[model samples]
Target: MQLDRTRIVVRQRGVLDTLDLALHVLRVYLAPLMIAMALGALPLMLINHLLIAWMLPDADNLLDIPARYLWHMTILIFLQAPLASVFATTYLGQAVFHDRPRLTEVVREVRKVAPRILWSLVLIRGVGAAWLLLLSADRYGEFDSFVDTFLPLVLVTWAIGLRSFRPFIGEIILLEQNPLVGRDAETITVGRRSRMLHGPASGDLFLRWWTSAGTAILLTGTVYGTMLFLVGVLTNDWRQGRGMLLVAYPAAIWTVATYLTVFRFLTYLDARIRQEGWEVELRVRAEASRLVAWLVVAASVMCWTTDAFARESTDPIEAGRQALSAGPSYPWYDKQEDGLRPVHVQPARESALNRGSRWQAATEDPQRESSWGTSVLNALAQGLRWLGLIGLIALLVALTVLMARAFLMREEPGSDDQQAARGLSPLEADRIDNLPFSITQPPKDLLAEAQRCYQQGDLNQAMIYLFSYQLLALDRHDLIRLTRGKTNRQYLAELAAQPGLQRLLRPSMVAFEEVFFGKHRLTLERFEGCWQNLDTFHEDLQRLVTP
Candidate 1:
């Protein structure tokens, strides 16, 4: 379950690894993280002490009004945003290497990602605030709901659960070499990447979803519970309205924010590992490094052992006698005037796995020059590749045809209910609307009746006339059967079988109810559009029905 942080590989794992990784980040970066938070707290503390406390109507009350609660968060997040940016970026840097940046560098990194951090904080908190407003009915804008109230409980649960969705938002922003701008850029990127993170429906996000969500809930509970307990004890008055509740809440908020920041870095790597074959890459590098180490060990052993070994003992006693009589046993030992002196030796070259991996990598070298035979063989291979591609395409086409045939042959479970939105009865289509101005009579020609309604500016009747034109045309073409009642959705569903009809008629159907039943004003442009659509359907119907 312990990940090799050096290789930075993610694997298909269960829940235990998720908790382990979260704790791993906490253990490894606890010191630097505290320092970062301490620095973050400086600004937040200043604002809370000087500005926010005095500004609130009842400074001590954490649950006086929803507006006050909103104001508290607005100020808190404003100060925390820059420091959070620093925390996220620094964790990313350390995730790459054990070396975390210095304070100044962390600050610089934060400044670099200030736009993304501030904007994201604003957006998420803004959304959270909106949710609170809609759900909680107290003061429109203040957090008057107490700790014991359902509102706070709901807010806490929501915040905890919602963390998983945007886990990589901070990482994406800070690490995105080319960043996106505008309101929903971060939102768009997070949603897009979440697809890759969770993966396809077959696995059903089992790997990413369960792990991240579970870890989020667990960490939220553990961190917030401990902090809340501490805040209560320190304030010595949980029941009394102390502003420390405000401070305590922010502390818990920052703790989760920071923890998730680091935790998400690992999760992001896991997503990459699944998507990019990082496990394979890491294995290759590890094997290469092991091979290189064995080689170095063998070389060192050879250098100092056996007959051919350069550093093997050449009779130390004899060499000492020889040093006094002649010079030295070997030329490597300097015949210094003051006995044997140390020799300067060159350091062994360190072998990197990356270099060895490149050496052992599966690759083919291109021929600088080709012979006639080689050229002919290459041309033959290229021809074979094209033939294979064409064969594959043909096979795919055959497979698709088989699947479609199977689908068409299969009987639907509900024969009665699943019947195509059938052609309407004449009585149904020509039913009198009984409008204030319109004459109540069935028309001989449905299209002409529709035209008459349009001419009279009876939009309600005109829309119904247009719908009748579609149903009649469809029935004439035998595309649908007669049904006494066919809802718009039912029509659209049945029309799905006929792509041309679906495409041409879908918009008109959707607009039908709105214009006819929902008080749409009469307009020439609208009338013309509806008439043109009906006319288009009638022409297509004639062509299909003619033969």
Candidate 2:
């Protein structure tokens, strides 16, 4: 329950760092994570396949039906990814605290908040609405534009937009366990917490989501492609088959989704660290807890030993009277010597001082003597108790001061400063500073810059400028978005729906990747070839734009 005792260090991390850390977390908890993910996703996958299986022809030779089933299931998985991640999210919450919760424990924890998950993710967010709609259409391939295409498009767009702004709903619902609708103003409902956590950083969240989406798409493709290549080599079957569609493709997608689930959890932590000074709060709370524990132990020991140091008198009469008067109070000697010293038995001296404390004791007390060591010991114990109290107060003050400083300086080393340090332009820096590569310049200037680079025979620079111009142009037309997080492969995937554009743009993208990423030498002929492809793509883009 100690926040400061997390497996990972509590601190702010950049988007890419979060991604990398997610990978690390996944590896560390791979077994439990896989078990949790499988438990949640397998049933949903089966349900999805069953719902759409009827749309496929009953004929055993229907590859197209199975392929369609595959794509539909892929989309279904994307929609339901957050829902499936519920188990992983719960397990990772415990994993963050270095606890390897059993699958039963994860399920139990999830069961406690099942209604919230249902209401927030399934009912309110509509994660499962598409499937529910699909359930009504008893036939497949009867593609009504509204029912099959437009409705799904609208649903997807709405979901994406909603999720882009508020992707941590699963974490909030399952992990935080906030009430759906708080009855009082002081209570923070799930909705309010989501707004409070995500509101200030909306732009940041979008960029992070944008970047993560691009990366996830690329990863899914890479995984799927690898699986295809392996299948082809092993069985000489390059065509999409039942196994490829139903098994390989979904596996690839789910693999990436599981990793992304971990990534989202980390981002949640980072957001808390940023907006709420969560790391500071954890440390302060932990220190305060320890202080209180120490105080309890010290008080317990003092109380436990109190009876052993009861005050005594040489006169039994006086002692009896003192004990009688001491009724409900602590031992009399507790007030002296800090109540920690053992009895010092003075040898029976014919001293009248110890005989009586009434009229005779007043005059006899001055005649009695005490050892210097005893006086020094008593003073030291009393001084130590006072010092202990003062130290506890000082510790509390220091913790308060530290928390204040952390809050005040949380925004230090501002984003602009980080961008500047990385040598990125304002525009490029603002997009995502943690991206491995800076995005292309705006389309208006990049084409001319590419031409200039070509003229100067700086082929590498030319290729980069050319590629940037291409991406920026696509982005301008809303055909595909340009993000620093995206790579050549991701862009190609984005343009998959438009075969014409993709075909024309393919050569240039490949050439750019070769000369830029593959570190291949760019010959004059190759540069000219890339240019030719760009011209064709530009012409097509203009036509598309005009139309």
Candidate 3:
């Protein structure tokens, strides 16, 4: 595997950038990732069905099973998430280096570390114990506040805290192959490595965890909502059937969980890049390897050149014939009736060239078919390695272009605060303390303020203003019921019936994410695009209000 030539660009990335990039990655490796996740999750799903889903069979209410199972399943999946990610994490570890690890290889790698995983994730992290807890609650639907509620609540809270601060333990054990126990004081054990990796960046990891959790929740809801819509449309029924409870619901959860596995891996890479200068180390090691490869090639060429010279000096005729023919030389001896006879004698120094041409000789000789097959296999392997390198380069280039666009625009610190302070009603100030636009402002005034911000070259603030205007205009037209804590995607999903409004808000939301969450400087091109969309949106709002 090549150290420098990775499938993704090795660099420090903000939480949003990493999250965005994971979508592209999911598309590329969807099949394998899905398979890996399913392989890990299926057994656990079966076990939970028997333990939790079956426990509430005698509950009085018909909806008890669905509610009880989903509630228990949510906590179980959260606790078992790291365990379920073992296969995917191992596969991604090899994939990052552009190596296409086979299924058996991934399984074997996980199997080798099964003991450690069980110890650290299952026993110590209480993954198995969580299952046993649910099992111990014998009457699952009884809803004992402590056994059914407080216990699982405490488990989930602990999981959130542990996973948020140290989310990449699966990667550490599976990818880094850190020993569970240190052999000596100099050696780093898994515990020590976790601290070393997570200690300095604890705060950032916690923030990223909240961001990822929010995104995951949104994605899960979107997917589950889509599933419900499809079921209703296809069957003309909206009831929560057994299939929905047993399959669709869990599928949605696992699907989002699978995607987050990729997100988590990217975060791990980002953390390493920030804390360890891992990209620099990869580059240095890659350069050293390239230098070695070049030196070997040069030495081989010199040896071939000197050997040719030696042959020419000793036997000019044979040397000329061999150079012109560019084929393997015959053996010095031939089998004859009398015995081995000298057929075409050549100097011993020229024999190395003959040895090097053994592959060609084997292919020409039908009797040595196995040797020929071996040669073909070796060539194919080399070709695959080269293809991996090419893919690595291409992926790097694509990710670089994407990151360039995502990170180009950054907001000036306190720009929003300064803008918000200028014109404020006390009520508006209290509502949106840092937002540059009043929630109560007319859409036209918000648009004008955004224009002034752009005119003043505060592109980021301008984009925020445009985004704010979008929400204001939508709220005024009664397109959406705007509320705090609702995401832009949620708003877009709400406007799904209005293609015109959805079209305008979609790209604006992307720009909004880059400016607000990504903290990128809004470029002129992006600002203009948002400006156009908002202008069109404002016109649409006027038509709606006028009618």
Mind giving the per-residue lDDT tens digits that candidate 1 earns over 51-95?
Answer: 344434554453564455444454345324434545545555555
TM accuracy, model 2: 0.53
Please provide, for model 3 over 31-75, each residue's C-alpha lDDT reduced to its tens digit, 9 standing for 90 to 100: 999898888999888887887766434433434555666788888
Model 1 TM-score (2 dp):
0.41
TM-score-wise, the better of 1 and 3 is: 3
What is the TM-score of each predicted model, taking all chains together? Answer: 0.41, 0.53, 0.55
Q: Point out the higher-scoring one by TM-score: 1 or 2.
A: 2
Distance (Å) between predicted and true CA of 448, model 2? 60
Query: Would you give me the overall lDDT of model 3?
Result: 0.77
Report the poorest 10 consecutive residues by lDDT, candidate 1: 430-439
Q: What is the lDDT of every predicted structure here?
A: 0.56, 0.77, 0.77
Instruction: Compare the candidates by lDDT and give the number of the best one.
Output: 3
The parts of candidate 3 lying over 4 Å away from their true place are 55-65, 306-547
**After TM-score superposition, what is the CA distance of residue 420 in candidate 1 from its true location, in Å?**
38
Clashing pairs in 2: none
